[model samples]
Target: MPSMHRKRNKSLGLLELIAIALGGMIGGGIFSVLGISVSMVGVFTPIAFVLGGLLALLAAYSYVKLALYYRDEGATYSFYKKTFPKSRLVASIVGWWVTFGYISTLALYAYTFASYAISGFEFANSEIARKAVAGLIIFIFTLINVWSVKGMGKIEDLMVYTKLIILVIISFVLINNSNTTIPKILHNHEDINILSIVIVASLTFVAYEGFQLVINAVKEMENPRKNIPRAIYSSIFITTLVYAIISIGAILAIPFENIIQNQEYALASGAGEVLGNIGAELVIIGALLATSSAISGTLFGSSRLISVIANDGYFPKFLTKRKNNIPVYSIITMAILTFCLILSGNLVVILEFGSVTFLLVSLLMAYTNFKIRKHTHSSLIVTLLSAIGLMSGTVAILYFEAITKVEQVYYIGGLYIILTIFAFIFSYKRN
Candidate 1:
């Protein structure tokens, strides 16, 4: 008779890391941002996206350095713990907040998918049907995640490819239509300012959030030290180029005022103007896939967060159960919560709340980078500059919204703060 010990799964290879990075970065942001960014920056929207991409690259560099040096699964939480060992509670808070941020983002994307899907059908136009469809979409993706991580990964790969193809096709079509003039919308505008550009850039930056999801799967990466950084930078470069082209095409096709007034599906409308009805339809389908993929990837990554918290004894042990290596219970829980959020039909509010929390997490990550530089002798100059860029960009966005959309900002922030406090108390009591 012989006994054998089971071996744990190893690190992810370069291709797998690229898959994860592409899956994360090519989601709802590109699908949804054209109209909004154009409204804010006019024909300069493409420039704004490029500027945001630069900042995202800096953040990605910081994340890669942290992941390689620390070589742990906690991502930002791990960085914070190592840098601020004396403030473990703060690290825990940041970790919990990041989990909440991702979950909220998942809910937002689910709601967006539902809204778009419903719009495509007669049922979505109806209030009740819209909510029902939204819930159904959320639940279905949740189940997909619960069933198997491998299955979810395959789905994300397909989605990333589809999105990339669609973006390329649209870019080609728009560029081919050289007759389209770059509308001089900015010439007449009085609102062009640094603050406005920063706010728009921040919004554009959010589209790049998925790059870090690759790092979360670092343990699953083969030679994460080598492969992960390449994937992160490569994905960012490709996505940034795609986004800039799309934004430019959109502004060139449609006038700025029209985009502002028609904020819903602005990018698709612009594509239609450039490529006719067929191009617009393709863009819509692409947007649907983009939102669906974002929700799917968010569910996949967010469930891991819950699994981590449970493994740490911060949540019920049942939540940590991995059926076929997937956290079934946590996935189902997140799906249910996401379903409820979709039912509320408040995607914008959910997005704002998610952005606020995520920005806070980024702030903490920046601080962590600052602290860890002393230990690793990593480039302190780049780290500090990145932190400043992130914080300033986040504040600029928040400030813009606070001035013009004060009520929405207050409501979303207040709700997130309340939820954060309650979650903290619950975790502390359980401990």
Candidate 2:
């Protein structure tokens, strides 16, 4: 057992790095967002997924540049802090926002895991039962991570690759069983709003949020410069393809009403109806593995960043507590807060907040890269475009929420206010 600052042997290869990145990106993301996307864009759901991937790719440009330049495992916060070393406030704000962003995603993944786990039970729709299950899973993974680093990595590889295979199989099965065609769905939705498609695409960016997890693995990777870009770009491209095919199969095989009706367990319910019980079971297994791995990977990376922030005095010193080379306090704190969010049972609002936070942080990253383009070997044009694209995504999601879910807008706004206050308080204390 080693302490927090002890350097372990770097054993992860390129494949394992890809597994971690994919595991982080795919968890509960597609399962959670598919229904919302279809509800907004109708037959154009797959198109929105593609557009969302493009936005993610644009954001990755800045992140990869920063990762190569700094090569620090602190990720988003470290990039900002190193780029603007004099601005402790900038570092504190980025750290808080990025940490909470990961927390929201963790909560989202756990809640979705619970949704699928209990989908077949008589009390499947019981909110209380769902929250209880969510808490149980988070606690389970927290223990796994705090127990052993090697075990977590091995389990992540197994779960990530296995779930991907299941997802691909499910997509094909649904497509084979379909009674409808793409053209027919398109013709039926000919009157759908184009703006609606763009808005859904912006919101769908949340599903592509985990690619940055690769940069967080810099300390454990073989080659930071090469593997970082290879893993991220490949993961995003593969994720986009998988999501597109799944959305296509889903819409053609099942009705949109069922998807929206069973939003939490959309694929499971849809598969049950079209391909019988085994199809449904396969989907359940895939969702479970996807989210389980996501929970583990997110906890692993996020706890490290938390430790880094705490070391800088932007967070409570107690958060730097470690056991057996793991950040025990940070991991436990994230799990508890995530469980509380699960108790809130407002997955929709949580999803929106997660999206807004990532988009804003990404914009900041792009701006930081733009400011120091010469050193990072980044392009001014591409970095500027990344910022513009991310800015539009933030505005699009907020505007869409205002028009459709005004209450959610207030909820997101209030969360930002609380986070901002904590950031400044800790930052001032550090000074």
Candidate 3:
């Protein structure tokens, strides 16, 4: 049985939860993945985004069900504990891996913002200037998080609202200016198959991973059981619609070939091409806001994970200590790790490895759902569905890893397994 010793300050409202979800989901992936997605699926890139959203919705449903039943602070960790008491060590490993993945994602978004800001300036050709700007941005945000999570949350709420308004405006503009016939969706496509769609869609689906972070906020939610589900589903629905319209407009504004060539900021470039310099600037600002909001939210959530782990006796008890009713040490630890990762300048590799770790954790979560159904005699239908959804998503990610030849996936997977073994060995000896 998992014990909840510390009570959380449940001050987050539905808007805050929604802001976190939106902030996490709409990070740099939206700006960065457009070219790659276009390359993979052609004009059907928008369709791939919608498909990713549906799959994410499925995962969210599973999480909602588990949250309602378990109501534990550990999120996935607690779910696994209820289902596999003896496998507590494995659950802890999964939880840590998940936290690490989100941290890597934060690094990726920070790097993306640096890349965009550098490219926007006349002195962008100066390598030293570029690095300095990137480092300064990371440092500023790290300080923001270390100083106060609640303060960061307030900033994120404002940032998220601004980004949402921008997306809505962009979508409205696209719909109003759509001169191309809708038939081009099918008529322009030359080839479409399961393999191609999944290959292309996986990139866009990465954006949808933001929904997972909402579960971390459950402890802070006033009424998690009801609010979490509503927020998750509603955010997904709105983001999906926005992504589809923006993607299609981007493709129509710029030729598919041109979009593929500008791999970095395809959406912004397309916006610039169609809507001119002002539109491009708006999108760029949106990108910055999106990335900053993501970093803030991840810092908040990952600190909670650290606090949970410490409370479980995995680390020094100091990590569990709270100041002003907040886990100060845990938050600082997360900021330090993120700062170190920013220095590596290997943000892309970190993201791929992070995705691999996350996939493994998701797989474990699904398995836990399945095991819970078998052991506790609870409703099996949703659990089974959740397991299937997680498995499908995981398999897709693995396939993506292999196809992309990201060798880091194998190394990360092997290292995590080794760590899991060692953690258990130490636990056994200590006990």
Ranking by TM-score: 2, 1, 3
lDDT of 1: 0.70
Q: Pick the candidate with the highest lDDT.
A: 2
When 2 and 3 are scored with lDDT, the better candidate is 2
TM-score of 1: 0.90
Task: Mark the 10 consecutive residues where model 3 has the least summed lDDT.
Answer: 1-10
The CA lDDT at 269 in model 3 is: 63
Per-residue error (Å), model 1, residue 400: 1.4
| Residue 6 alpha-carbon offset, candidate 3, angstroms | 14
Error of 2 at 23 (Å): 1.1
Q: Write the per-residue lDDT of candidate 2 for residues 1-431, one digit (tens) a residue.
A: 45433346365678877887787788857887888888878889998889889999999999999999999989999999998999998789899989999999999999899999999999989999888999999999999989877788888999999999999999999999999888888898998887788788787676777888887767767777889999999999988898999999999999999999999899999999999999999999999999998899889889888988999998999999888667899999999989877777477887888889999999999999998999999988899889999999999888888888898887788877888899999999988
Q: Candidate 3's C-alpha lDDT?
A: 0.68
Worst 10 residues of 2 by lDDT: 1-10
Q: How many residue-pair clashes does candidate 3 contain?
A: 0
